[model samples]
Target chain A: AQSVTQLDSHVSVSEGTPVLLRCNYSSSYSPSLFWYVQHPNKGLQLLLKYTSAATLVKGINGFEAEFKKSETSFHLTKPSAHMSDAAEYFCVVSDRAGGSQGNLIFGKGTKLSVKP
Target chain B: EPEVTQTPSHQVTQMGQEVILRCVPISNHLYFYWYRQILGQKVEFLVSFYNNEISEKSEIFDDQFSVERPDGSNFTLKIRSTKLEDSAMYFCASSLWGTSQETQYFGPGTRLLVL
Candidate 1:
């Protein structure tokens, strides 16, 4: 079984400041991690995914995340926060130990609030 | 970009009533899934359908819940005798057959409000 734990339920950041959202995961094998963002009234959008390729993965909208094997973490970051970045983010992981065909497990989700 | 589309974005039903949520997955996709998220809760996987049958299902996917692909284009989730606890946002997603290793495209979701 695979599980993801998001450290924060809500995070507030000022526009133009650096933003970081922490996430940790437990998997039986090399995991495939993903970060998804959901804007108000919109479907979940893929921000980034770590598929055993590169440790540092860059995504759209100036967002990126680093997958650390030792820490079992995949934390999302951005150089600066924008008002439009305010949304709910979910950390997800799949059971690669089960051959990557396993269903995805989603974290409780963290709400990002950007204040101008 | 091809998208997974869901119908009846919002549905209001009384307890014990049956409701069916519809979805049209992307063309050429061979895998379909249904997940639900209660308000302020983590998304829970209900079932995964492939090759016209369920590949996997969770405990929440009891006999009360069912899925079907009546046509090659439409996939539907039916809840028989919905309870108040059934109110939540249900998401339908799909991915190509061999692309199970990739991310699945999700729909905007159908918000079912069981009164």
Candidate 2:
């Protein structure tokens, strides 16, 4: 079984300050991890993914995450927080059991707030 | 870039009524999926379709729910009877391949409210 756990239910950061959102996972096999952002009344937008490739993955809007296998963690980070970065972030894990039928498992999600 | 699209952005229905949510995946994509998010809850996967058949489905996709790719370009999820618990935002997603390495693009989603 595969599951994702976002450490924070909500996070607030001041504009121009650094931001961090923590996520942890449990999987039996090698997993595919992803971070997706959703704005109010909008669809989910992919931020980045780690598929056994580079541990440090870069995403759109200057956001990035590091995959640490030992820690069982994939934490998203950004050097500077912007107003547009306010949204809900979900950490997801894909099941790798069946070769071609991996369904995504999503976390409860972390709501981010940017304070100017 | 190509993206997945869904129809009926919002729908309100009475209990026991049937409802169908539609989706049009990106051209050339072979895998399609349906997911939903209830108020104050995590998003949950419902089903996945490929080659006009169901590839995988979750426990939430019970007898009341059925999926079909009636035409070449459209995929639909039918709820035989609407229940208050069924009210949620349903999302449609598609990926070029079913591999774990592939990225699944999602649509804006349909907000279904059951009365």
Candidate 3:
């Protein structure tokens, strides 16, 4: 079984400050991880993904995440926060298993709030 | 850039009524998928389709739930008898290939409200 746990339900950061959203996972096999962002009334936009290639994966909109196998973590980070960066973030995990092929296991999600 | 699209941005139906949700995936993509997110819950994968057949499905995809690629450009999901618990946002997604390495583009989603 594969599952992801987002450490924070909500995170608030001041504008221009650094931002971090923590996520952890449990998987039996080598897992693929992804970070997706969703704005209000919008679709899930892919921020970044890790497929056993690069440990430090850079994504769109100045966001990035590091895959740490030993720590069982894949936390998203941003050097600076912008107003538009406030959105719902989801950490997802995927691995080959019965009836789970090509399916992603999504976390409960973290609601990010940017303070001006 | 090409992207996936879905119909009926919002739909309201009574319980026990049937509903059909439609999607148009990115043209060059070979895999299609359907996912749903109940209010205040994590997004859940319902089914994955490829080569005109179901490749994978979760436990939530029961006998009442059926999916089809009715045309070259359209994929559809049908719920025979919707329940109050069926109210959720349904998302359609597509990927160039049904591999873990590929990124799946998603549509805006359809908000279903089962009364």
Candidate 4:
């Protein structure tokens, strides 16, 4: 079974410091990975996606994630943290074995807290 | 920029009552999906619709749940009989194609509270 696991349940970072949120996935075949962020009471916003084209994928809001197949990881990182970067982040894996869209397996989200 | 839109930002209803969550996906998109997230839990897939029919659905989407693309533009999810466990945020999403590789844009979810 394909699954996603967010290593951190909560991460606190001081403003202007670096940020890192770890995620790992298990898939039987090639995986399409994604990172999504959700602000309080808001819909999910696509942060970045790795669809086999690139190992390093950059997303909006100065966030980026690297797909490490050997490690089975897609961890999100940012050089500097902003107060606005505080939100719940989810790591998702899509089943691509079939041509049709499959249900997204989501990680237990990690909440980021930025302290000024 | 076109995005998926859902209605009734929050809804409160009694248990056993019927509730319909409405969504209008990106006009040109052909595939639609419904996902739900319980409070403080991961998002779970409910069902997927394409070509005016259900293409796939998860076990959580039991007989109590049904999806319809009644017209060309609107997609709806109806719960026949709501239960207390049904309280959660329901999200509607769409993609240009029904491929796992395609990005599916999500809408502001409808928070359903079954009391």
Candidate 5:
């Protein structure tokens, strides 16, 4: 079965420091991976997505994620953490087997906290 | 930028009562979807619709749940008989097309409470 695993339930970092949120995925075929961010009481915002285009995909708000097929990982990263970057992050994976819009399997989610 | 919009920021209803959640997706979006997030849980996909029909649905979406695009501008999800387990934040989303990395814009969501 296709699944996503977010290694950290919660990650805390100081402002101006690097932020790393780990995610791993398992799929039956080629995969489409995505990262989404949600603020308190708000809907999800797409941070970035990787679809066999580039190994390193950049997203909004100074966030980026690298899709490493060999490792079966798509870890999100930021060079510097900001107070505004505090939010819940979800890693999702979808199968691209036969021109289908496959359902996404999401990880439990990781809450990121940036301390000033 | 155009964004999806959901109505009734909050709705409180008794179990067994019917509830309808409305949404207006981006004008150009062709694929629409419904998802729910129970308190303290991951968001789950309920259903996906396109071309005036349901493209896919999950086990959680049963006969009691239905979706309709009555007109061109509005999409609605109706729960014929609500249950306590139905309480959650319902979100409506839309994407330009069904692709591997297509971004689905989400609505503000409606928080439903079953009492």
Candidate 6:
């Protein structure tokens, strides 16, 4: 089974400060991880994905995540908090090794709040 | 950029009534999917469709749920009986391929409120 756990239910950061959202995953096989963001009343937008190729994945809007196999973690980060960055962030994992249809298993999500 | 689109941004329905949620995937995409998020809950995969049939479905996708690509461009999900617990934000997504490496683009989603 593939599952992801988002460590924080909510996080708040001041504008221009750094931001971090923690996620840990459990997978029986090698997993593909992704970070997606959803703004109020908007659909989820893919931030980045980690296949086997890259450890540090860059995503849209100055967001990035690092895949650490030993830690079983893929934590999303940003250098500076922007007002538009406030949204719900989901950590997802897919079990490509199972050869099953790629259905994503998601975490409960972390709600980010940017303070001015 | 081409993106997936869903209709009826908001819908309120009585219990036991049927509801059909519609989506138009990216023109060239071959795989389509449906997911939903209950209030404050994780987004869950309901079903995946390809080759005009269901390729995979989660436990939540029961007999009450059915999917159809009746036309070349439209994909629809019909719920035979609405339940109060069914209230959630339903999202439609599409990918060029059905691989883990493929990125699934999502739509704005339809907020379904079952009364």
Question: Quick one: best lDDT, which candidate?
Answer: 2
Question: Residue by residue across B1-115, what tens digits does model 5's lDDT show?
Answer: 7888999989999999999999999998998999998988888889999999999999999999999999998999999999999999999999878665677888989999999
- What fraction of the reference interface contacts is present in each model, in order? 0.43, 0.75, 0.66, 0.70, 0.52, 0.71
Q: What lDDT score belongs to each candidate, Candidate 1 first?
A: 0.90, 0.93, 0.93, 0.92, 0.90, 0.92
Clashing pairs in 5: none
Residue runs of model 6 more than 4 Å from their true location after superposition: A98-100
Q: What digit string (tens of lDDT, one per residue) describes model 5 on residues A1-116?
A: 88898999999999999999999999888788899998987778889988878899999999999999899999999999999999999998874543577666678899999999
The digit string of per-residue lDDT tens for model 6 on B27-81 reads: 9999999999998888999999999999999899999999999999999999999
Which residue pairs show collisions in model 3?
Answer: none
Query: lDDT by residue for model 2 over A1-116, one digit each (tens)?
Result: 78999999999999999999999999997789999999997888899998888999999999999999899999999999999999999999997753556788899999999999
List of clashing residue pairs for candidate 6: none
If scored against the real structure, what TM-score would every candidate get? 0.96, 0.97, 0.96, 0.97, 0.96, 0.97
Which parts of model 1 have CA positions greater than 4 angstroms off? A98-100, B98-100
* Interface DockQ per candidate: 0.55, 0.70, 0.55, 0.69, 0.57, 0.66
Off by over 4 Å in 2: A97-99
What TM-score should be assigned to candidate 6? 0.97
Score candidate 3 by lDDT: 0.93
Displacement of residue B72 (Cα, Å) in model 2 is 1.5
Poorest lDDT segment (10 consecutive residues) of candidate 4 chain B: B95-104
Q: For model 6, report the TM-score of its A chain.
A: 0.95
What range of 10 consecutive residues in model 1 chain A has the weakest lDDT sum? A94-103
| Winner on DockQ (3 vs 4) | 4
Candidate 4, residue A1: Cα displacement in angstroms equals 1.1
Return the TM-scores of chain A for each candidate in numbered order.
Answer: 0.95, 0.96, 0.95, 0.96, 0.96, 0.95
